[model samples]
Target: MNIFILEDDYHQQGRMENLLYQLQEKHALSVKRLEVYSKTELLLQAVQEKGSHQLFFLDIEIKGDPLRGLEAANSIRQRDSQALIVFVTTHSEFMPLTFRYQISALDYIDKPLDKENFEARVEAAVLYAQKQNRKTVADTAFSFKSKYQQFQIPYEDIYFLETSQISHHVILYTQTERIELFTSMNEVLKQESRLHKCHRSYALNPKNVVRIDKMERIAHFPNGMTCLIARTKMKETLAKMGGEIE
Candidate 1:
């Protein structure tokens, strides 16, 4: 996971990096990017550009401005509600301000920087972030490996899958792209329950079906893309769709 530290003190900044590296060496944590920002604006800019779940360590005071860190935390919450935020400060009294600002901080670590306590809190935060990531991937993503590439796509983005003319290949269609997979419809169906085999060659996501034409035996999706629906399976498909046809 990405990690961001907002601290103006050069010594504390170095110490934080050293501890993170030590944690990595001990196999206690994994970091994709470790960045330190002395200013709140820089930190928020990075957050907006990165646009992913991250771990944040914010000092309660930046350049002697007492409320700067809390303001930064509030901005980060507005941008990414799932971010794990930990306050690193000597001002434990300011803890109550977190609730007032509605910043759902993950943890608070006091900053005379006790080595043992710091490591423990950092490790726990890393573990929590990893657990959250796994849960999100399991709930919303579809994973598959083809001969050329592996893909993990969000379920809502996928529109349909169809057998390709090439042997043992299937074409996966999404809102923005189409991919060829080295797999069969049976294997795909086993992985995702949202897809239903509407025809011999096509399995479509009922959620993405914008209109169904019983007369033409067609299922229409976004962008005017259409998939064939077998006459025999039409009744079953319609039933699965709660009989909502347009």
Candidate 2:
């Protein structure tokens, strides 16, 4: 749970850092907290360079541009839809304006901030982010981006994979979805060698495959899908999948 605080005031910066450290030490919290810049370039770098941040503590009002904080946040959300954004402001008036930026301002603490409310909100945000991480599909937690958004296709959901063109890819079939994963066959085999390379270009996830027809040189799955096993690679695939399954 990494937290990036984008507040410019020196005194307020110290206070936020202190609060974050206290929570992590006393609560056994998992966090990588930092105070980011008020400058636009620095703020942009803060949001882009990280793998994933659990929350953004943004001050609605900063020095140079009154709306720069919101601008930085908008950019951050474009890349990561899941990151939590909580505006720290000195007035309730900004509440109405927060929506214009399309941010899910979880719960902003108004100026003359209440100690109890501040603590409660931070605690809630941390717990919520942790919950979301736990709920994501575990079978294939690894994900990639599409034109619309990022999607994860679990390794277990892969019906079968194939390799070619000096690059490897997986033809992933899930309950109600079909996906093409951008990965190399060699990489997949290296990760899970249990996958049977039934052909020069195919790697079958045995769990989804129901049977192999040697006469037809094919593998049949319970879902009525079939894959041809090249004779050249049949012997190797057999040795890996075993002659029979229990």
The best candidate in terms of TM-score: 1
Itemize residue pairs with steric clashes in candidate 1: none
| C-alpha TM-scores of all predictions | 0.61, 0.57
lDDT of each: 0.81, 0.65
Write down the RMSD of candidate 2 (Cα, Å).
8.5
Tens digit of per-residue lDDT, candidate 1, span 35-96: 99999999988763212247899998998899999999999887555577999988899999
C-alpha-based local distance difference test score of model 1? 0.81
Candidate 1 error regions (>4 Å): 28-30, 48-52, 140-240
Worst 10 residues of 1 by lDDT: 46-55
What's model 1's lDDT at 133? 59
Residue-level lDDT for 165 in candidate 2? 51
